[model samples]
Target: MAVTLRTAILDDIAPVGHLHHRSRRSAYQGMVPDAALDTYGADAAARWWVERWSHERDTHRLTVAEHQGRLIGFTYVGPHEDGEPATGELYAIHVDPGHQGRGVGRALIRDALDTMRERRCRRAVLWVYAANHRARDFYEAGGWRPDGVGRDGWLGPVPTPQLRYALDLTVAAAEPATPAAAQG
Candidate 1:
């Protein structure tokens, strides 16, 4: 049941996209309409990822979770143009539907956080669908607090609201207990 976390390479592109598309569709099926999820196909996800990851000027980091040489989950981190230098956004955190609840997410996240720290990022941010209670609970349990919620009408198949979560790594480090370190 052990999962290894490491920096994702170009060779990981396909599997990463596959995991994202599958997990997103499966996880968002009930919360999001089938048509919306269908709009986000594996090809589109792969194209988006390739554009970002292939950019030399990009400071984005992709952390992948692997077990028995197969990718099961991944987390992507990168600088946010609209935020401070210490601010980074977790673009995506996904685990295969069949591999959920087996600690792959935690490993992927831990690796992403470590990369953020190396980038001198003081805070991390992400957006999750408001209707996806499972994702909300997962992020909340990982110490992310809801900072805001808004409708991304142009961005959703369901036109549902999205909740924003923010976590201050500086404050997190000052605390007596650092979950990332313990989890690692």
Candidate 2:
């Protein structure tokens, strides 16, 4: 299936919310607290997305992937909240469980990185659950590296271990092709 990426709008809240909630539940099933996942549903996620868009729209960017007119994946990127001024961050990226391995995620990441580069960001960073090997592998295959930094974060009421991943966007631009864009 051919996937297209575009900026997300307010009208996309419902579908995006459903996908986000579903993706989180599937991706973090064994890594996050069951209780936290239980309370996270489509409605709650929709509200959360709306709130984030309302408050951070100016500082952040949201991109969605669509296949045959259906929203299947999304990515959020922006200036790094805890890093240097030239550093960008990939705050979140999710592809519906039903749509995994179909290039939706690969497209989203490529689009996110492109946006970061357009914004003149020199580097990028993101955090992932330490136990999420699948996601870690995906990012690593996309040329992201673990920065040897770890932190404690709450997945609902459960404390979880997270690791930081970084990419030098300047170096990426100097290369002929980005791993994400080169993904088959």
Candidate 3:
């Protein structure tokens, strides 16, 4: 089944929040400290997410993925906080635990990059938790490289280490696509 990506609307708040919270809890289970996860329960996280998704257009954009009419994942992007020239930031990317590894994330990322490029963004940037090696590897595999910066964790209570990754869209555009002949 093909996965579809579209701009998130007000009606998507509930399902998007549900997927975000479940995926975060399951994906970050052993990676983040237990204390932090315990303190910020999934319900709280869902509520916070609802609030953000409900009214965050001023500084960010949201995209959702649907497969077989079910919401599977979402990605958010916006202006870079540090104000880097020609850069846009990917604020969040989450796929439902049950729907992961089925190309939903990859689709979301490609759509995000294309959207940012269309917006005149020269590069795409994001931060990944250092301890979440799986996510780090995923980003790296998708052509994101480390920028050697760590900061207070965004989700955990402790100062979670983070590594910045950036992709230059200009260079990406110049890369040759697989020849149509190759598919014959």
Candidate 4:
């Protein structure tokens, strides 16, 4: 089935939440304690997404990837978390584990980069849990490099070490056909 990427609407909150929970658990299985993973459930994820989107929609972009009409992945991007006007932050990217390694994540990432480029940001940054080797590898493969900064982060009330990664967005490149322009 062809995977389609598009901006998420209010209607997608619930399913995105569900998929997020599944994705997180699958991705963090051995990296995080089962108890910590359970601290935030699907319903809570749904509500969090709802509240977040409601407040940040104006400044952030939430793009979702769907396969056969089912939500399969999502990426969230916004202005740099610490108010850096020329930088953007990739807040989250969650892919349905079953649908991973099939280019959905790459597509979403391309879309996010395009969006940040459109927003006139010259740099982009993200934080990843230090123990998430899979995620770290993925981001590194995507041209992100750690800035040698570590910070105290949280995952459902569990304190976790995180590293900040950055990408220079100022290099001009052909705009790839992304979700916003190609599909939605």
> Which candidate leads the pack in lDDT?
4
Candidate 3 worst ten-residue window by lDDT: 175-184
Candidate 2: TM-score?
0.91
Candidate 2 Cα lDDT to native: 0.80
Residue 139, model 1: Cα distance from true site in angstroms: 1.0
* lDDT per residue as tens, model 3, 1-184: 4988999887787677677777777777787776765666666766877798667676678998898888888888888889887799888889887776766677777888887887889988888777777776667666677876667665656566677888888776422222100000
* Alpha-carbon local distance difference test for all models: 0.72, 0.80, 0.73, 0.81
RMSD (CA, Å), candidate 4 to true, equals: 4.6
Residue-pair clash count for candidate 2: 0
Predicted candidate 2 versus true structure: per-residue lDDT over 150-172, tens digit per residue:
89977677887889889998876
lDDT of 1 by residue, 2-44 (tens): 8888888888887787777888777877766688878868988
Error of 1 at 121 (Å): 1.5
Sort the candidates on lDDT, descending order: 4, 2, 3, 1
RMSD to native for every prediction? 4.2, 3.4, 5.8, 4.6
Query: What overall lDDT, based on C-alpha atoms, would model 1 receive against the true structure?
Result: 0.72
Predicted candidate 4 versus true structure: per-residue lDDT over 34-115, tens digit per residue: 9998999999988888998999999999999999888989989999989987999999888888877777777888888999
Two-way lDDT contest, 1 vs 3, winner: 3
TM-score of each: 0.85, 0.91, 0.86, 0.91
State how far residue 102 of model 2 sits from its true place (Å). 0.9
At residue 64, candidate 1 shows an lDDT of: 82
Which portions of model 2 show Cα errors greater than 4 Å? 173-184
